[model samples]
Target: MRIRAAILAALLWVGPAAAQSDPAEAARHAAQLLEQAAEALNGAEGARDRVRALTEIIRAYEAGLAATRDGMRKAAIREAQLTAELRAREKEVSRLLGALQTIETTSPPLLMLHPSGPLGAARAGMMLADVTPALNARAQDLAKDLEDVRTLRQLQQAAADSLAEGLAGVQKARTELSKAIADRTDLPRRFTEDPIRTAILVSSTETLEAFASGLSEIAAGEIAATNADVSALKGQIELPAQGVVLRRAGEADAAGIRREGMILGTRPRAIVTSPTAATIRYRGPLLDLGNVVILEPQPDLLFVFSGLQEVYGEPGQVIPAGSPVGLMPGASPEIGAILSTSGEGTGTDRSETLYIEVREGGRPVNPEKWFRTDKDG
Candidate 1:
């Protein structure tokens, strides 16, 4: 076949275009993960190790939500591209349909019979044979494009419900994790915090450096020491949160205020974790930096994270690596906001800012040197 060859050519034309990316497939996978997380959340209540189960569920929800957001954004883009292409080819498609309709309605005998002579008829038949395949290919392409537009529209409509469910699930998981952390009492403590001394230090300190330098004064008794050393992982440590670097070390912000640390742009209520096993040197409000968690992974090295709505764990407690430290401040975006911003590509999803500082021997250093900052959020 001629028909088979024409069909193959039509398929070849559509194959690369459809193979570019499948946002609907990605969204479906994310939706499945979110569904699994919801099921895990139900079972977590009755699990023997509720805290650990809840933590995994929360992490799953966070991952699923992030993927879902990305999928929706991509879907929006793909839909726009397809819509624009269809509009651009509107006249060509109309002509193609009209020609196809004429071919279909006209008798084959009439099409082959040219008016001029036998030679003209023979020439017309050869031309018709050549043009038929091209017309069929165009028709196939037009049909595929129309089908893709319909599928993308349907996917976008379904995405709203999925996003809403995922947002609610993640929020519930976060709340439960917070409560579980508060009730937890089995973690090893390095030292008991003196509230009076901490209050005094908070009042007296004007900058984060001063508060960090006086951390020792806030301890009530002899500090339980450990030989935990993460210097070997100096440049291998991951960032404590899922975000993109907004401002690098010593980069000035819009207000022209520069700090010796990095600013990360994170999604609202994104989970922040300890990059490595570290002791909680300090946690809570300090100066104007909002809720903060200062982790001392090594004796003289400290990782300071600020701009949290809620902080976990008490001061002077040794927490394991990847333990939840806090949550970024801001309400999660609603479904409407997500859909409206999906096509904007303005990074409105990452609306919260997290301030991170690495202090080595009580002096600020570029966090990029300590953490792997090459990957995008």
Candidate 2:
């Protein structure tokens, strides 16, 4: 489509004699491109797919939870069965004990009355006759049934215990699975992929102080300005609430003015081996840069700040770069720059690091060229 638009534009540029020189052709081509873009966007259905995937994941979790609950219910049923069996066995044992007790008491009375006078003997005989072998067999059968019930109850109890353990295990597994999904959704895939997070972690006050000391050592003497041609411009350009400026320090050009300042980095105090004073500057509108400074040092170039704080040094202050200029009294809203290293993301991607720009020939160069790798301070 772009090729087609270019061809059409080229044909139209061929002077007024061509019939294809209509201005409406460009609008028609734009509409076509818009239609194609819309079609491409519709093909992926990203939002709809994301929602559907999330819903499916939730449904999977619900299913797992339900299965675990059903397992628990089965365990409860098995427990009830075991309990009932135990009760039945207990009742049977009680009946057998009662029968045994009655047998023991009657047997004693029969033996005590044995060998008495003719009438007493006959009465004892009648009593012994009442206690038949059939009763003994019946008592043995009752005892056997009680033992069988006890054995069955024991087996059921074991089965119930196993079921309960299985249910608990399933429940625990389901809970862990749910937590895993939640964690996957919340946590990023790679920790180091986020430079901002890494910076935040390393930006502790003590670390900053140590790095500041390192900067002081580097900035002690006149550091060799590699791209001095671009870094020498000086002017307070007014930018909007969300705006950024990228410049370099070097020889003055037709449009660039020469300005010098101290080198100040992110140290609240001096470290063991490094100096403390730094050069800071302001570049934007009054509302944006209440206090701003650019600290230029060789090999390890940086930008310093005192955002929304009072400015201590004037534009031409000849103080050393690391000298205390001012303090950042309030938070500074980030300004996004349209540079390669600016990274790609939404509003949250804007970083809090001071904007560093390298310049030569009064034009901006990439700051990454002077980036330092030392962090041992």
Candidate 3:
């Protein structure tokens, strides 16, 4: 049908003008070439859309190709299906390129019947100019996916090595084991708050310390139902995070800002546990702190932990000391940049920082005095 349309258009273009010269004939031929070019362009466009979809599918499969202690999940089935789909997509792209070849290698010779001689041939070279970028981009994407496959293999190897280490140290679990406990606790929720509301309520306050002060009023009725004495555990409490103290109490937070809490640079995936048996006052992302949790160990005493990547406990939940509360997602390049600008908490290059504060009787108190471990001091 495309060929017939090209012929018909060329015939109509052959009017009552001089047909003796090559110029008149070339004009008619150009009309025919344009018709065929448009048809090829349309088909190639459809093929390009299909190839884009195929690339997206390949990337999705790559995303799930993580290494694990149990080995890659559904490895056999996913790999086979991805291979088959890639093969089919490659064929479609090849066919689309073949179909577009007609414009360049016309059997009657496109150059012979052209008015501008070599210039006409050069113009025909640009017939598929629009299609080149799409094809080139897809080619680049294929290369990236190839690299992703290699990365996924490396991840698998890493997971296997980690599993072996964990198995060897099964009986000696202590500090390193905290990350899992902090990150993956399955305690029942006493209550939950909307993250959006908690976020908004926190933003309305001046400082993070002030933001925490308001949370003490949450579940105020439950005050009569509990008994936890954090003051009694002073100088004997365990460190919540395992790391060195980066900033001591009364240190500068940013340019001109003063900090009320002590900042500790903890290892990645460091386990975050409650220092004392306490009831949760609030838990969620706050104004500057990436993720913050407020705990009420007793009336008029609030313990604050900030810079967590994930929190497993909910607001109003009561947990004992050394109980898993959350995980400090180790700071990466992305989060490090955010922390530098957000003025939330200082982050180290490789480790994450957690801001620890103790509020007693409506006032911020020194947190370093509570922990007996070398880490907090």
Weakest lDDT window of 10 consecutive positions for candidate 3: 61-70
Model 3, CA-based lDDT:
0.54
| The 10-residue segment with the lowest total lDDT in model 2 | 266-275
Q: TM-scores, in order shown?
A: 0.90, 0.20, 0.45
Candidate with better TM-score, 2 vs 3: 3
**Model 1 misplaced regions, further than 4 Å:** 1-20, 46-49, 341-343
True-vs-predicted CA distance for residue 293, candidate 2, Å: 2.0
RMSD of each: 8.0, 30.9, 25.9
The number of the candidate with the highest lDDT is 1
Give Cα distance to truth, residue 106, candidate 3, Å: 90
- Please provide, for model 1 over 105-200, each residue's C-alpha lDDT reduced to its tens digit, 9 standing for 90 to 100: 999788877789889999988887899899999889878987878887888898888888878887888888888888888889999999999999
Pitting candidate 2 against candidate 3, the one with the higher lDDT is 3
Give each model's whole-structure lDDT: 0.82, 0.33, 0.54
Model 2 reaches what TM-score against the true structure? 0.20
Error of 3 at 226 (Å): 2.0
TM-score of candidate 3 versus the correct structure, residues matched by position: 0.45
Ten residues in a row with the worst lDDT in model 1? 1-10
**Tens digits of per-residue lDDT for model 2 on 201-296?**
334424332433333232223333343222232232111111122223343535766323111222111111001222232222222333344344
Candidate 1, residue 238: the lDDT equals 86
Give per-residue lDDT, candidate 1, residue 39. Answer: 78
